[model samples]
Target: MADPLDLFLAAPPGLEPWLAEELRELGYAPQTTAGGVTVSGTWSDVWRLNLECRGATRVLARIAEFRAFHLAQLDKRARKVAWGDVLRADRPVKIEATCRKSKIYHAGAASERIARAIQEELGAPVSDDAALTLKVRIDDNNVQVSVDTSGEALYKRGHKEWVGKAPLRETMAALLLRAAGFNGKMPVVDPMCGSGTFVLEAAGMAGGWQPGRDRAFAFEHLANFDAGAVSDLRRLDGGTSLHFRGSDRDAGAIRGATANAERADLTQATQFDMAPVSDFAPPEGPPGLVMCNPPYGARIGNRKPLFALYGALGETLKTRFAGWRVGIVTSDGGLAKATGLSLTESAPIAHGSLRVKLYTAQL
Candidate 1:
């Protein structure tokens, strides 16, 4: 049998449980951490994770891990790894190293040593624009080396070509939908809907679209990966269609959302409108989900006016969206409280440098 896959999925801080649950739904047992999750699978499974997983920032395949006391031992172990089996000599590769509380504390030297070994011993061409990236981390006297399987961050999705200021990432949007218990059978509305990220993600989920279908991953450059299998998997049918709706007061945001939805082939699945939150109307459904990433005061121009915006949002939700589930992503807890809804649960999630929280409520 093929060697078991040692996969590590890095997430924004405080999102480990969300990533873990997502992986479990994909038929893997993931061990959660403060920064990420660790799991085991095959090469095909790794492809699936890169293509299907929406909550992960990057998917890494652990190649080697050992205890190293000094630079000589680190170099010897790094050189002995079966790089030929995993990496193609025809493709250029780059190594990034990090050291913490280790005898060999110089990360740059370690990276240079590994690069030299790959170039001199394995005859591999090293390039700055290498498609494949190897990451080395020395923590607690243990050296861990991993290969990045996803070329670009999974959040890119290749569909959203336009974005508003402080737009939410596609992966974080998808996770927020999942956290809100959105199964795509009901309508979803985003009142603030900047660049329509949340709404588009909902539409994709409702339409049974795979996030990575149109993207390229780093594993395609590996020597042992089967290109045919990857192509076949992408061709697999995703069977589901559900209603999705989005409205924003900004006309520019609406136009961007329209174009982005078209790029994702989701125009048929999503409906976008130019309307302010006060004029927003809930879609025709029993009890669906309403998710929004409103402008936080830090990025936007004013803070005092935003409080009124949040209050208006709360009023609208209470008056219009009875029985609907609500999820709001925000960095300001006080502003979140302006909604005046009884929060069912709230969990912290990292948004770049800011630690934002997803506040959810059921009307």
Candidate 2:
């Protein structure tokens, strides 16, 4: 049996607490820290996280750490690492380095040294286009080396091929749903569903579907990979009743969303239609959560007409969606206020270059 590893679940800024909560629900003891949550487990846990955890942007294994004050010392210690035990000789790898408050201030030089060490010691070719990456961070003379087990970002979800402009990432959507207190038992409605990210996520949760069942990870190329063990992790628990729905004014968006649902095999659990917010109506069942990511003029164009759009959305929810809860993601505070829904703001989350917040309210 191999020794346990330090597993770090990377989250977006200001969403670390929610991600930590999600890890706890997954039956792991998680320690929340800046930018991420940390836990300890073996290779099986790594595979399980990549396959099941929805809120994590990346799952990294902190394989090695040491102190190095100079380049020669760094190179010597790097060469001493048992790279063959963790990395493969046939697969190409990339090295990314960052230096902070350390004597080794040159990040490029540090990356080059590590790259040379891997090539000489493990015989693995280094390339910028490699899917596997080794991250080196030097903080106050302490060097922490981790491997990005998740090659592409986890938000890709392996099934969502089509997307609209200013689309929300799957990771962020899951975490926001967590913050909104959504489990799989209740229905979820997205009024402005672009490609139906929230609806698809809700259906997957209710249907007991693994997020990475259709995806591939970089860990498959590592020396510790076990195909049979990983395959066993995909056993589904047989999902609950379906009650997810979505709507959009654009005909093309509805078509794309329906296609995405079909690709995920979640069509039985979800419904998408072409309707503007003013025409939005609640599902016939018990009241659930209403979530949407509306245009905030920063990513999409014009801000003026958005005020009227928000006003109509607020009116529809207030009058039609009685006994329901609401959550909206927008960058502009004024736009959120235009809804007039008595919303409470969450901590600002980093969305690309722009920071956005999730506004919640009970209608």
Candidate 3:
């Protein structure tokens, strides 16, 4: 039997612990790191992680690791590694190199050497446009080579094709949902749903659906891919019945969210309506969670109007939704406080160029 491969699940900054917790729930022992979580598994584990993990931006498998002080040694060692076991001679690959505090100070030169080695040894064509990527990092004279098993960012999910301005990524949405203590059992409500990302993700979790089911992965191009095993892994079993709801003031966003729910085959479990936060109300039955990512005003260049919006949202939640939990995502603390809810803030999270946090409360 081949040794287990080292798998790295890339998490957004400040969400490592939540991602690690999610991985542990999936029955894998994960060590949380600054940027992500690391686990030891085989190629089959690689495919499963890419398929099941919702909070990971991507999954990278460490193909080779060694020490090289200079370019000659790097090229020689790169060529000696067996690339044929994972990469195909017919498929093109893209090489991306990062050099940090290493004798190999020039990243472009290192990438060129590795690219040439793959061409000469594996007979594979390298192209910048290729979807399959090999990430080479030289840090403190330690060289690590990894392959991006996820072709597109897992946030794509191939379900919600429409997005509004400065939309929340689906991966981040999943992690935030986990952070909010959602376990696929409670109902979810998003009053300011942009493209219904939170609603759709909640419905998927309740439906026992795989986020990667409707998509393709870069691992399919690798030599170790098993078609039958992947087919078996994609088979889903029982799921609980839950109603996830969302509403938006924008008519276009409502239409798009409904379409996205249809595409995900989750319309029965979700409902997107055209309504503002002032008109928001909890669905019938026991109280669940009210989660939303409202405007932060950084993009709008004004913070005054958002205060009213947040205050109105807080008032609505407090007045109508009794015994429900609340989670609001935003970059501004003052805005989050404007709601007047007793909320606790999460660690600073990297959202594009802005740093945001998830504010939680129970009312």
lDDT, each prediction: 0.84, 0.91, 0.91
Name the 10 consecutive residues with the lowest summed lDDT in model 1. 235-244
Model 1, 57-105: lDDT tens digits are: 8899987788888888887877887778887778899888999998989
Lowest-lDDT window of 10 residues in candidate 2?
Answer: 234-243
All candidates' TM-scores?
Answer: 0.96, 0.98, 0.98
- After aligning candidate 1 to the native by TM-score, how far in Å is the CA of 16 from where it should be? 1.5
Candidate 2 lands at a TM-score of 0.98
Model 2 CA deviation exceeding 4 Å by range: 236-238
How many backbone clashes does every candidate have? Answer: 0, 0, 0
For model 3, name the residue pairs that clash. Answer: none
Task: Give the C-alpha miss distance for residue 291 in model 3, angstroms.
Answer: 0.4
What tens digits encode model 3's per-residue C-alpha lDDT throughout 1-363?
Answer: 155988899988999999999899899999999889999998888889888898999999999999999999999999889999999999999999999999999999999999999999999999999989999989999999999999899998988888887788989999999898788889999999989999988888777888888899999999888999998888444355789999999999999899998888888899999998999999998888899999988766888989999999999999999899999999999999999999999999998888899999999
